[model samples]
Target: MPRRAMLRSAAVAGTAATLSLVPATASAAPNRWTPEELKDRKRVLEAGFTEAEADCWLLVVRATAAFFALPELHPLAKPEVVTAVHVIQDKLMMRPAYRKYRAANP
Candidate 1:
């Protein structure tokens, strides 16, 4: 598999993992989204994002969730960490072979 495909797979896995932790009814329903739900929403948005856009939005979700899940990472003030990761993921998604190779590898 190519490096780009690997990166996209990692991002998708990360996003899926994060989504799994939240209850399905949270954001999909009427109430205001919990912080966790917001984070998940952000992750979904980031997952669909491209590198040219504000890719940091997705990173914010992942980093925030990571910080919440593992306080040891201490991602308190690091708002842009998730964005950086999303940018990397987006770059990988742009590669023509990424999706094809990802399907084959997975």
Candidate 2:
């Protein structure tokens, strides 16, 4: 599969898996998101997304992080894989619904 396609598949699969699990609340200390994740959560909430949407977006973010950590993506010195990974990550930063929220808020 193409790199982008593989990444998309990973995200979709991850989202499905996450949806089946209980979601973590922002106030949950043990389940607290990373600092960067907290920032993203705040941004999405302020952008008018519902709690559920923010949760899903965070899951997508996590899914991409896992994808990047895969063994296949090793050897960061490879020019082609590095460029592809960058492009994929940039696109994944905002899902379509998240974009709509930001656009509406802006």
* Model 2 score (lDDT): 0.60
When summed lDDT is taken over every stretch of 10 residues in candidate 2, the lowest stretch is 76-85
For model 2, the stretches where C-alpha displacement exceeds 4 angstroms are: 1-18, 22-30, 73-106
Over 1-106, each residue of candidate 2 has an lDDT whose tens digit, in order, gives 9976676566545545665574654335325678888788788788666666676567656755676676664453244444544454445445656778888999
TM-score (all chains, Cα) for each model? 0.29, 0.47
Compared to the true structure, candidate 2 yields what TM-score? Answer: 0.47
* Candidate 1 residue lDDT tens string, 17-48: 76455445333332444677556555554655
